[model samples]
Target: MMKIHEIRELIKLIDQSTINEFEYEENGAIVKMKKGVDAQVVSTFVPAPVAKQEIIAQPTVTSVATIEKIVEEPKAAEEVAKVEDANLHKITSPMVGTFYSSPSPDAANYVSVGDKVNDSSIVCIVEAMKLFNEIEAEVQGEIVEVLVKDGQLVEFGQPLFLVKA
Candidate 1:
């Protein structure tokens, strides 16, 4: 996990960088930051409700965007869960990166819709900062849907596949 000072430094570095968004995760802690057109600082981390609220409430920052919209936005996410079939398992991206269906441009995809997969099967890869991270289908099931296309940018926790277990 990143220390409080480290998080602050990251926020500053992201604010100054050309990139518009960044996400870092250690263990299960995640830090996400975004810069809007006005250059306001927008950041979030999961599992640390206090850290999340405190970051928004920090007095040192000139203008931190309100967390209300960010906080409320995820509430609507539950509705999607309700809409999905109860027996289906969602394969989600663990980090913010680009989704790749195959190992190489001409290689066969790791898995396709209608393909059977076990708990340890490599379903796809997500590339972040030149690192190719192989993504696994943690559920034993048939992939019923592929939610993302190759070379697409995906967000942390965004579902990439739906499987019927």
Candidate 2:
């Protein structure tokens, strides 16, 4: 069973964050909560409708030990090349975005197959929102494998490149 304080803390986090809903399970109890949104489409002719805030909370208990066990399993690491892979550097995404290898639509890619990169070299670009963030090589090495493709949606901490140092 979840304590009341834990539930309150979850509520506060939802209010502070951009997330509209949150749910969690603890000690055999499941809790579902959501914050209501008030979207008002306004016109120039009349007064806008007042927005009201609503908070909903629901709770239940069920066996979830099997589901939890599956989620806890560690993911298998991807094997890149046949060469000695012990000294390879895993270049991961710094933000949640779409990855692009080139600066512009018609421009050549920053790095290509068999390209050597130092710490300051820009290997790719991660586009989050309207901003294009340059992803640099943190270690000096030859690019062994490009794990992601152009315009691929990448999550935070997702591996984009494997470099054999």
Candidate 3:
């Protein structure tokens, strides 16, 4: 459970910034605050979507952009490299297999670090039962890291690349 003081502190933090969003954890509780209509703040627990409630004061359009900028931090370029460094996205082998970065043993890899890709980008190849399978990117982003080395075995959902969208 979260403490009321922590929630109040979060409100203060949100008010202090140009970014209209802030999230923090205290005492095993995760607290998130988002700017709401009319200078009011909405609070919610983690793993649940935030629900809106009427606020006494309506927020100005300028504040809305500030909030957007804050919420958009996930897409910040600096974090992109962290995602790659952390190997966050796990591209798994759909079938039991050996993973290859290229169509053939002698070819270059399908995708490499810093490659801009869309949801349909073929980032790598997986070999199962002597057949080469094209593994496509499920999300849009730049390739951050390659978790598995070429010619390595991979399991289902095993991380292949970290992408930043």
Q: TM-score for every candidate vs. truth?
A: 0.53, 0.52, 0.46
Write the number of the candidate with greater lDDT, choosing between 1 and 3: 1
Q: Find the candidate with the highest lDDT and give its number.
A: 1
Q: How close is candidate 2 to the true structure, as a TM-score?
A: 0.52
Q: What are the RMSD figures for all models against the true structure? A: 19.6, 24.0, 23.5
lDDT for each residue of candidate 3 in 1-165, tens digit (9 for 90 to 100): 766796687677778887766666768777777776476654432333548463343435557786677556645855886555675555556765888888877888899999888888898888887788898898887887788898888766566777776
Clashing pairs in 2: none
> Candidate 3, residue 91: CA error in Å?
2.5
C-alpha lDDT of all candidate models, in order: 0.85, 0.81, 0.73
Tens digit per residue, CA lDDT, model 1, 1-165? 889999998888888888887888889998988787775665442432334222233344344355555555566775776677676898999999999999999999999989999999999999998999999999999999999999999888888999999
Once superposed on the true structure, which residue ranges of model 2 sit more than 4 Å away at CA? 1-83
Q: Tens-digit lDDT track for model 2 on 96-117?
A: 8999999998999999879999
- Output the better candidate (1/2) by lDDT: 1
